[model samples]
Each structure stands twice: as C-alpha cells, then as structure tokens.
Target: MTTFRKIAALAVAAVMTISMGACGNTGSSAADTQDLVVARSLETTDMLPQTGFSNGDIWAIQQVYQTLTRNKTDGSGVEPGLATSWKQSKDGLSWTFNLRRGVKFHNGRTMTAKDVKFSLDFARTARDDKPWQFLFTAIRNVEIVDDYTVRLDLNEPWAPLPSDLSMSASSIMPADFGGKTETEFRNNPVGTGPYKLGEWKKGDYIKFVRNPDYWETGKPKLNSVTFKYVSDANTRSQMVQSGQAQIDEFPTAVSVSSLKKTRNVHVESFPSTSLIWVNLNNRRKPLNDVHVRRAMAYAIDKEAIVRAIYYGQAEKANSMLSKNLMGYSKDVKDLEYDMAKAKEELAKSSAPKHFSLTVQVQSGDPEKSMLAQILQESWKELGIDVQLQTLDSTTVYSNRTAGDFDVAMFEMTNDISDPDEWMQYMFSSSANVNSGYRNEKVDALIKRAAADSNQANRLKDYAEVQQIIADEAPEIPLVYKPGLFAVRDQVKDFTVTTLGEYKLADTTIARE
Candidate 1:
C-alpha cells in the first residue's frame, strides 16, 4: 500500500494508486480515470484577480485556449507554446511570435493575431491596481503582424518579458471572447490549452474535460481533472487516503509524520523561500512606533515556533529576506524572546496604558493561528494585550491591501529570481502606496536594482535595501516555509516549486 507520485518532465500527467488491504492496487486508464480528483486546503470562492484560483482558473480555461509562448517544463527555457517560435529585435523593445499553425479554440474557431491582440489589450486595458492587473501593465501594446504572427511592444527593456509571457495570466483566448462582460466570459470560456471547462458547480467543484486536439500532440492523458475545494487539511488528506481523491495539496506539518507512516502515501517536501512576516502597519497607533515594532520582533521566539509548529522542517529567517535569496545575509542575528526588551519598548512608547493590538489570522490555515498564539503569549509577558482576529482569507487579504489592520501576518513567495522581486512588491514607494509601507531609501534602492542589469551591482544595491528594512522595522521576519505535498504511490514525475505552483502537464500515473 505505497504510492509514489512524481510529476513528469512535461508536468502534465501524474502517477497515483489506491491499494486495498493485502491485494496490490492497479492504476486506471485515461478513459477510466476521467475523474481525477484533487483536494486543496485553500478555497476558491470567486474568480477575482491575484488569487491562485482566480488566476489558476483562468489558466484552466486557457488550456482550452493557448498562449503565444510556453516555459518548457524541461527547463530549457521559454519555447513554443501556442506560438511555434518567437524572435526579438536588437533594441529589445519589440518582439514577434510565430503562432502554431492550424490551432483552433475550444469553440472550434481558428486562433489569429486578433485573438492575441484582443487578449493582451483587454488584460492591460482592464487594469486595476490589484497584483494581477500590475502583471498585465508590463506589456505596452500588442499588434497583429499577420494571421499567424503577433508582435509585442515593450514599455521598458524587460529581459524577463518572455518568462512573463509564460505566466498563467498571460493565457490567450478567442478574440470574440475578449470584450465580453465578466459574467459572460465566465459562463463560456474558449481557451486553447489542453482542457476545456465542462462544468463549474460554484463553491463545490470545477469539472474539466480533455481537449480532443490539445495543441501538445496527443497529451492531456487523464481525460479530465476535477478540482474539489476542501479548506481543511485533515479532510483533504483523508479524502485522498479513502480513495475518494487522487491528489491533495498543503497538508499541515503536524500531519506529515502520520501520513508518512501510512502504507501507500508518498510525501515530498519542497524547499521554498516563502517567508511569513508580521507586517506592522506604520499607519497604526502603537505599531507605528519603531521601538514598538522592534520590541515585538524581540518578543517572538523563532526557534520555539519553528520546532513546535513546523517540526524543525523549516528554517528560522532572521531578516525579512530569506537566506536562499540572492542578497541574504548571514550576519543578521535571531530575535530571541526577551521580556525585558518587550517591557522596555512598552514603556518607551508614549501610547496610553492598556494598549491593544490586533493580528489578522486566516480562518483555517494552521500556521497563522499557531504563529498568532505564540506571539500573543509572548507579548502578554510584557503586559500587552495582543488579540488574534480570525477572518476568511478573502476578507483578510482584502483588508491588508486596504490598510485596515493594526498588525497582520502574511507570506510572500518570490515570483522571479531577482533582488527586485523581493524588494519591489514590499518596500518600493509605488507598491507601498498600495500595500501601505513606504521608505524613500527603499524606493531609491529598488529603482536602482530594477534599472541595473548587472547581477553584482544589483546585489550591492539590494544588500543596502535589506539593511534599511532591518533598521526601519516595518515588518518582522519569522520563518521560511517548506511546502509539503502528498501523492499516491502510483503517481510519478512530480516536482514542487518555490512558488507553490504544482504543474502537472508532464506527470504520468502508473500501476503500483
């Protein structure tokens, strides 16, 4: 009763198994396994921008659609996805892509340059300050060169433009479908990817069907995938163990030990640099004080939390930036639990007696609750009342962007491998206006890092930026999370990335 799952080289298929008592289990075929069930701890409530489901749902719909280019899962870099190949001009401001020949949308219409122009333009024109909208604004404009050729004009000399094109949000859809109202498009999506949306039972399940002529040369092996949202990690894991589901994501660190001892379940720990931090809103009263922020940093015991909650599977992060990141510093010391310092800060702060602080916590995510409780107890030692306010992830994230909380804990996974990726989103004045954290020095350093293409020079600039953040104390760093995923023994070719995205295009499921 052992299942080993690995995502294939292409990350499309998966290897999974369901064993019965003493009898060995056998895997099913694409025709028979048309119902591939997956359970996730995160819920997909509505299709809004910036969330995994909002974007991932669009990606699924686009699989019925297609993109101009694809990041080959083989790691050779960006290659032909919906587009056969592409080339850039010497100035690097303009680029052209040769579309895949004879590719048709799920609606049976042929893909054309108009489709490319319409999709990119619509995403950009439909911009909001939300993160997804920010992603789209990077493209200056797009034009139709021919029925099969499309060109993109850049606003700046972006080296990662090709990689950005491969993002799930950059998915291309039918031109006619572009200008439709949100409600209309959600009802009927015509993508060029491998799977077509068959049915969406709001709040329950989203069913997909394999496109008969998916552009990837007779792949989409599993016929269809059924994503069932279960916000509870224990329940999701149980669904997989009970033969009700094939794959499940985000099992708690506590359940890892027991799940590992189980007969047929295979677990893989992905080393991710995604770090959870206590974002001290500078606009708030007590938290607005720098000493108060620094004292809260000294109050939390990083070692105890990592050991007790994460089971020593995670690394203690000293700086807001992680060690695995490019500008990581080894000199930053751990902020041990110091009651004296916490008291000193409480006294130093001119705020009145009985000062209260609120820390927003997502309803079901275990780490948030655990971290909040640990921090609450630690802060209580200094006669401070720290309250944990539990809210739905949607509400919590929304309020965070709106600058409505005193203290909040959130984790960030680097989207790209650059110093700017970490600094740009959090400290830059532009992002700060939205995220509610701004430092002039941080803004300058980020601008320098973004402008400098040289790695060595960029590193120096980012190192200074990190030191500024360390001193400013707008946010307190906690721990670098390790992503945990479980696959059935029959599943193979799976790899989890630091970004927490599970790409299943090349995985294959086999009999155990």
Candidate 2:
C-alpha cells in the first residue's frame, strides 16, 4: 500500500477502536469519578523543569510547578505566582522578588529564597541541549537576600527579565532535593504548585493529585488530573466524543466540526501566539541560495492552506511575531503566492533544474501531512521534486535541531509577552533552533532590542529585524493557528490560554 493508503488505514483503525471502547464504557461509572482525563498528541517521560521542550511536557509542568510570576492568559499583563511582589533597582540591573510565605513543595519542604536562587541559577547554567537556557543567560548572579527575598543581578539592562521568569522552566525546586542526576530528577519531580505528582506510566498516562496544603485555598477543584498520551488525532477526538476523556488538546479541524454536533462536547478556540512555519535548512544545498529560499516562499499558498486544511481557523502569518505579540509590525507583508515569480527566482538560482528535496512532518498529524502534500504540488510546478517524510515528533525535533533536514514543519509558542522571546530563539545565530540560518545584522538588532531600556527604541529595533527576516526568507511563515481544545460540557471553568496553557486549578465537573 502507498503512504496515503497506510495513513488512511491507521486512522480508520483508531476510530474503530475508540468507538468500541466508548460502547463498552456506556454504563461505566468512570465519568462520575472526580478524576479528569485529558488526551494529548505527544508522550514525554522526562519531567525535569529545564529539559521540557514540547507543548505536552510544558503543559504538564505548568500544573505541577509554580513560577515566580505568571503571564496573563490574554497576554496583556503579568500576575503574581510564587512571588507576592517584586521591585527593580534604579539602574535596572538588579531585581528583588518577595516569595510567598508558607509555600510547601510536594515533598513537604518549605519553599524559601534559597530555593528561588537555586532554580534561577540552575536554569542559567543548564546543558546547551535545553532550548530554554537562553532565556536566563542575562542573569549574572542570583543572591538569596533573606529567607523570603531573592535578588537577580544582570550583566545589562534586560527589559524582559520578569516575563522570562514566568516560564515553566524557571519553576522553583527544593534547594536540597536529593536528585543525584538529571534522570533522577526526571523520575521524581517535586514542586510547590496546586497539584502533586502521583504516578506516571510510560506510553499510557501521567496522573496528578490535588495538594491539600496548596497555597491557594479552595483551588484545584478537581481531585485528580490524568494526561493520557493519544498520538492518533482520530482516536483522540473519538475518545472525547464518546465521553472517555473529558478534554483533548490540538483537535483536528474535522474533529472540531464533528464534535460541535454532539450535545455533551464543547469546542473552544482562542487566539494564540503559536506560529506554524516551514523551516528551511539554510546550510543545505540549493536552500543556501537566497534565490531558492525566496522562490520556495513565493510558491506557498498560505491563504489556501489556512482555508482548506484549518477550515479558516487560523490567520496567515507574515513574520515570526504574531499580531498579538508586543513587537509585531503592521508594515511587514506576506509574500503573495505567484507561480510566475517562483519560477523567475528559481531561474536566477545556481541550483540544478531538477533536484529532489524532502519535507519532514510529524507522524499522526493529519494537518501537517496535508500541508506537506500541498507544498509538494506547488514545488512541482517550478520543476522541483518534493518528497514527504513522516517521522515521530521526537525524531522530527531531533533532526531539525541537528540540521539534518532539507525542510521541516515546526511550531512554537511565544515564551513570554516580549518579542525577544520569539525572535532571539528562532532567528539568533547562536540559537539552537536557528536551523543553520545566520545574519550578523539580525543578531545585532536582536541584541539591541533586548538591552535597550527605552520602549520606543526597542520597538524600532524589532521592526528592523522583522523586515530583514522577511527579505531573507529564512522560514516560510504559514499561519497563526488558534489553540483549539475539546472539553466535555460538564467540565466547568476550563480554559486554554493564548500562551497554550490549560487553566485547570478552578476547573470543576458538573454532575448530572
């Protein structure tokens, strides 16, 4: 059987299996229990705060851990998290955060300034493989001012320091936690959040139980939360439709339409800072040529893809920064889809007339597969042969990090409310996810934006950076896809934030 046929068969099998399970559980009492099961696409065995790179792992960490500050779901402001309040020095080089008193970790240890110092220091010095290490690079030193106060001194005036502290990777851990190695910490994670780690069964589900001594009283309405690893989109949707799972993340467009017809399911869509794009390996042959990269960018029909594949659920993106972000420029325009322009640019390149290239997509993602097929057809019109390669999420991420692909489909959420979080991580020459693309001018602009204390100066620097990136076309900006989730009707007060976080502390189940 061909690739398309094989994918179709797997999807059909998944739907049938879920349907059978739903039928068998019609009379079961699982729904009446206080536990809520959420189905997501990826499985992660490692739970270390600094090592989480995927959406699933980060989402899980948000529930089990607490950061110093929390970005508002709407992306308009920041709220207090583990820190009750904070102040900055006159020079903007030092920050002092006041810890919440009586906060207890999962292991029954009181969280103090010592734990805050340890967490920030660990984040700044973590291994290079961790993508979040750059977020803490500005910190020069972390000092425990007292039992409830900690100070961070930076090498320069980093304007987004507080926002950076809001990330899940900066979650506070026990200062004397007995974790000999990274693997040990992964196996037994501890935090001072509303929930505590309960059990983790690889390939199945990870469970978290409510913390009775949680700092916030009367929160974490649900007694327990279980995150089930369901890689198949069809199966994940079926699980929710059959009432087997209370929530599902990243549901397919088809599933969203079908679930709307059901009485007990609610499909919610929120504008997100997530950017899905086609990453071009700038160091690879043919792709290294600027003309070839521009040709590929002109060939993509982003509007059509957003319409047909996402069912008009997303907006066409023009740059790495989304419109909702702080530094997004309205002047940057998307390259129009024109086959004639694509051919013209290709003719000017030093690439062979006929060459085969591979585009990698995550396995079990129907939307990405459709996108790859669309690109394949478009590139064929320009006399380029394109191959679609489906790999698991882990392998796909690894290849992209190792610069082992000609082209790949990837997505990332803005780490914080600042443009520096998106631009620096995705386009900086020294960034791990740069995809072999580097420009000295772009790097300098990013640095200027991060260090500038003036708001207008920072915005001007970011705008220039976006213009340069648009001209070079390092990646084909696809769409600003909205974060969609399917929730059972009985699940009350549940919401998925624009930052791609699930607010479950106040979520409750309404019993019929």
> Which numbered prediction scores highest in lDDT against the true structure?
2
Q: Which stretches of candidate 1 lie over 4 Å from their true place?
A: 1-31, 46-80, 83-88, 136-138, 176-179, 321-354, 417-422, 432-435
Q: Candidate 1 residues 5-80, lDDT tens each?
A: 1111111111121112113223344226645667765444443222233323433443354556654433334667
> What C-alpha lDDT values do all the predictions have?
0.65, 0.81
Model 2, TM vs. native: 0.93
Query: Which segments of candidate 2 are over 4 A away from where they belong?
Result: 1-31
Model 2 agreement with the true structure over 394-493: per-residue lDDT tens digits: 7887787678899998777786777877887788987647567889999989988898889899999998888888877888889988888888877888
Q: Judged by TM-score, which candidate is best?
A: 2
By summed lDDT, the worst window of 10 consecutive residues in model 1 runs over 1-10
- The global Cα lDDT (0 to 1) of model 1 is 0.65
Looking at candidate 2, the ten consecutive residues that score lowest on lDDT are 21-30
**Whole-model lDDT, candidate 2?**
0.81
lDDT, model 2, position 251: 84
